[model samples]
Target: MSTNERLRRRIPQQDRSRAMVERIIAAGHTVLLENGYEGASTNRIARTAGISPGSVYQYFPDKDAIVAEVVDRWTDALHARISCVFAEALDGPADQLSVRVVMGELLDALGENPRLLRVLIEELPRSPDSRLAAFERRMDDLLTVWLRFHLRGHDAPPVGAIAWMLVRTVENVAISYVLDRPPVERDIVADELTAMVTAYLRDISLP
Candidate 1:
């Protein structure tokens, strides 16, 4: 019997829907990590998920949809983690050192899953879909709100633009670290980026 057949029999019909969906997402992560975006196919993902191709269809309209959902979940998690980092460090001295501490913590949290980060930065653009843009904007908007709230007392640059720039800069740095010929030291990159950003923001936010 094939893997799909075995999985169908092993999973009860009542639990199949959610189980299959999770399986598809998990398989997507695996396939994208292993084979990359262009190489990851619906058939391969279904095989990895141990579900029939038809089962994958029942959950996701197509591969793009599956990838999009995965990216969305990833972005949400990243935003939440960054928010936590800022929260813990927000009340400390509002200086470059404090920013460095917070951003370094954030990068460490992010480094746990380099593959997913690579897929998100490199593949999402190739997908050429509007939903990805919306997702990116939503994350930026959330970060913007956090900056505005935390810097309420300071004369800061435009919150929305600052947030957007920070998010894109981080994304670029992360992609470079992930895809460089020789992987760059994430710690060094994060520190330099934090320092540069802190300096720029300080210029505009001086009391």
Candidate 2:
């Protein structure tokens, strides 16, 4: 009957709701990957997840909500991967190779999840607020913090500007690869792009 006990009692319900949300998101992802954007439907996703269609509705009012959560999950995972790669460089000196290393890691990670990325790109415009806008904001915030953290001793480009440029550049590269329109070999393309950007920054940041 105590207040604290009542609050503790709600924790399990919240946890269960979160778990259901995750399951629905996962189901939506699989459906999207298999069916592409137009083919994916709430009923199919629910069937794929072994849940009733109404149950999915309980967690998500519509398919767009599911798509948003799927995109958010993908973004979180991508950030975690990049964060682990950058954590070592964040505390110490910055170097061209470190930049290359981060870029390479991002390219590699995206390569591994190309299908999911494709689904994301396809679903972006469909989002109510549009995933592209949200993604742009998230990428800028994360990259600015990480870049400023690492570019300690270096007189680097303005963190916010560089963050936007980096996100835009990498996103274009990723999209090209996703669409099979990359100008050259995808593996070498990211490295070359990183090298170009690194050299430019080094030149501009020079005293």
Candidate 3:
């Protein structure tokens, strides 16, 4: 493990310890959503987690470490939620409808935790070396691979570029749709994003 990874937090070895870590991370996330990053302190998280401050400190060195854990969990949940989309898209026709379904589901996942998502979107870029940043970069690479297979055909637009663009589309839309005043309906935003990506892919992809 890298020094940074080790420094972020501890890995629970037993099932019981693992559950405690999950609870602590989940509580940390709740603090973030309810109080924002500035208000999410280790003591507050420990209180919310129903654990001793020493227990929280034993696992996570600081607030950033807890935040990193939350981001990692969120991204892992995202990966789980979308795994089927990739599988279905790659197994058969990877067309616009598949794209539409995936985009819609992706937004729905974001809707599940708008406040925390907002904090992550706003605060993550400040530290390029953060684990959250690494998770996002890995997402771009994964999306690139997904696009390569999903859009495989003659004259396919560069998957790398398109993947980057698609990732940005989700980020922008999530930030707006999740945080904007009277946020746009999830379906509406999803439909528009699906249409835009579909159009771009169709224009370059062979029939």
Candidate 4:
């Protein structure tokens, strides 16, 4: 069966069942945080959720499925927060101030859950069809639109390429700041990133 089909098969349809599934996902997050991916088990997740192992199996086929659901929810939330930042940027000129706002918001959002962020970046296995990859693609499209509007009539690299670079650069640096616990202050990191991105955009916009 297709991946989507497998996912659909795992989702509970009834209200009570759905709540149980959510509980399991929450427990999965806790266990994954406490135990790391290799150490997390369905029994541990079930214990954390205050449910039996069979209950966990009722909602999810295996430990990996529960972890996927947890990651999916986390990515969806992070995607929404970052997407809103970009959406707001579309209304204003993509100036240095706008770039600063975007960078600041990104750092804040990613820093909100540093432990989970560390687990995601350092522990989880990534695949092409993973939720994280999907989140990146969505951000790329949003950024491409924003860049195209601001770079109109300017000699620049392909907007898609610029958007891809910007997304990856900002994501990596922000994740690093959150996970690495660098001695530099948060605002300083945001300021540097903002300056770097703003300068790059300006250079590209030049004829």
What CA RMSD would you report for each candidate?
A: 6.8, 6.8, 3.5, 1.8
Misplaced by over 4 Å in model 1 are: 1-13, 91-93, 126-159, 181-184
Where model 3 places Cα greater than 4 Å from the true spot, the runs are 1-8, 14-16, 125-157, 181-183
Per-residue lDDT for 153-184 in model 3, tens only? 56666788777777776667755777774546
Between prediction 2 and prediction 4, the one with superior TM-score is: 4
The global Cα lDDT (0 to 1) of model 3 is 0.75
lDDT of 4 by residue, 1-207 (tens): 766655552668899999998899899999999999998999999999999999988877788888888888888998898889878876787688888888999999899988888888888888898888998999899889878887888765699988898899999999999999999999999999989988897788887
TM-score of each: 0.70, 0.72, 0.77, 0.92
Please, what are the lDDT tens digits per residue for candidate 1 over residues 1-207? 642333232222567566767788899888888987788888999999887999887766667666666776876776677666675556555577767776676667567777877776666564433444564576577667667876778765588988788877876665566556355676788778888877776666667
Q: Which of candidates 1 and 3 reaches a greater lDDT?
A: 3
lDDT of candidate 2 vs native?
0.70
lDDT head-to-head 2 vs 3, winner: 3
Q: Local distance difference test, per candidate?
A: 0.70, 0.70, 0.75, 0.86
Q: What's the distance in Å from true for residue 26, model 2?
A: 2.8
A best-first ranking of the candidates according to their lDDT comes to 4, 3, 2, 1
The segments of candidate 2 whose C-alpha lies over 4 angstroms from its true place after superposition are 1-22, 90-94, 126-159, 181-187
